[model samples]
Target: MFHIAICDDSEYDLQEISSALQGLRHLGICFDETWYQSGRALIDDIAEGEKSYHLLILDMLMDSINGIETAKAIRTYDVSMPILIVTSTVQYALAGYQVNAWRYLTKPVDPGELVREAAAVLKSQEKSDETCYVVQSNGTVIRRVPLADILYFESSLHTITLHTMREDIEFRGAIRDIDEQLTPLGFFRIHKSFVVNLSHVRRLSSRSLVMVNGDELDISRARIQQLRHALMDEAEREHISSHRMRS
Candidate 1:
């Protein structure tokens, strides 16, 4: 099963996409779709904390944060999720290219087409599941963790603890050593004591960030700007990758 986020200001379209996705279940493509009334509401949820979605369906024309801008904001934190554009106008279709929209569907979307596009995304995720993150624990204990399941890593004094979706695993290591290894895998050192999985960041204040599991971590002043830039870059790459997928 996959989770999807759909954002649209109009109530009619929201229900339409929801119904369309629900119909896909018969084809064995299970999806749990969460609906948002506006782009801001969706982004607000994202900014508030880690509600993960494998895909996004956005409306092009909306008041205040339009779909493209909303998608751009999402791109800053998530670079690979598929984003589908739903609109009544063809003129807005090309604009989606800038946001790396996975596919564009005109108003009154065909249910069959939606199912086909969604199944394509599911097939892709199935092909990528074997990748894992291997790390050492307790000096000699080796652990192979699914990269996506890791929540964050906390270092206190000399011990490092991996807070994952499954459980907390503590081992002897320096934060810097793991930081060097995980940074390339979307981890960010927001503070000296914490290196977080940015994907798990649910909300942030001026001084701290709350992870998906509700644990709050301090953000050092020195790394604040760096963290913001990294998130933005992640979004940019996400949109770019969507285009590549289509190509």
Candidate 2:
């Protein structure tokens, strides 16, 4: 089930959006929603880790903190949740991109359009769930991180550090084990100390690889040819997936 949060100062608009989202239930897109009359309340809840949401529907204009400002604050903590901006004006549409908004809808929203966008957002989340990597510690699941969010894994002996977009997580493990597990999932052991997620590799040279986060990692000479082939296969797979999604 999906968890959604709607933040709007206007009660009428909030109810309208909620009503539109209800249509998703008929399409088997079940979700639980929370309503917030102010952006501050939503931001605080997310900041305190009191709640987690799959999607956020926000109104552009509000009393103290506007939708754009609220989104910026939330991004500091959660970067992957989809943000959908609902506003009367298009002026803030470009601003929404800064927060990686999924889409922007004009006020007096068409119920059909809103439902379509909401469904798409939830569908994408479903896809991401399939690629999530569960992190376990001491036989207990500690975290469920999406593989797409991870940049690379750095190993120093038995300690494996997960370098992600948000932060780094250190755990006791061996790089070889991780490489064997993630190899089929678009990861390559570029060096004995590092297994890089090809999806997050921005550039590659004979000697090293540049990650999306701007960190450079060495590529072992023996693995260069294999890494290049892995990258090519990954690109082809991504291209085919994109085409299928569009069709």
Candidate 3:
């Protein structure tokens, strides 16, 4: 089931957004939503770690904290989840980009536009859910972790650790073996000892990559150009996909 969080200082606006989302059900999209009156309340709930949401719909203006600030905070916890910003003016559109917001809508929002954007985001998420990495040990499945949750993989002498936003799992494996298996699934062998999920990467420099969790991993000198091409290709594909969705 898709989980969504919507935050608005005005109770009326919250209800309107929620009502707009209900229109998605006609398209066979099933989801549950949580409502918050302020950005701080939404941030507090997410920090508690009890819930994970696939999408966030935020109002730009609010008391104490605004939508952009809220999105910035949430990105530290989850870099991949899509955030949709709702506001009254177009002036905040540039600010939305800084937080990597998926879409920005002006209010009072049109229900049809909200449905279309929300559906596009949720459909992409559903596609991601289909591709999961199964962690196994001694013929037993240890865990079936969704690729979206994994930040990166770290390899030591004889142990491979799977690092996610929540916890780390250690298992016996070779980094090369993992690279061969996961490289086809958006994972990159940035260094001999590290393989990172490209989607969770926040910043990439010539020599290192900063992951969503603030961990920096070295990039092999030999793979720098190839990695850059791969990133460019991914961005192009995403652009095409977004265009198709909007069209």
Per-prediction CA RMSD (Å): 14.2, 7.4, 10.8
Candidate 1 vs candidate 3: which has greater TM-score?
3
Q: Candidates 1 and 3: which is better by lDDT?
A: 3
Q: Poorest 10 consecutive residues of model 2 by lDDT?
A: 135-144
Candidate 3 RMSD to the real structure: 10.8
Instruction: Name model 2 segments beyond 4 Å from true.
Output: 133-144, 148-247
Q: Worst 10-residue stretch by lDDT in candidate 3?
A: 135-144
TM-score-wise, the better of 2 and 3 is 2
For residues 28-53, could you state the per-residue lDDT of candidate 3 as single tens digits?
A: 99898989898887777666544456
Please give the lDDT score for candidate 1. Answer: 0.79
Q: Residue by residue across 128-212, what tens digits does model 2's lDDT show?
A: 7679765555543334488988999999978889999888877778899889899989999999999989988999888998999
Name the candidate, 2 or 3, with the larger lDDT value: 2
lDDT of 2 at 140: 37
In order of lDDT, best first, we have 2, 3, 1
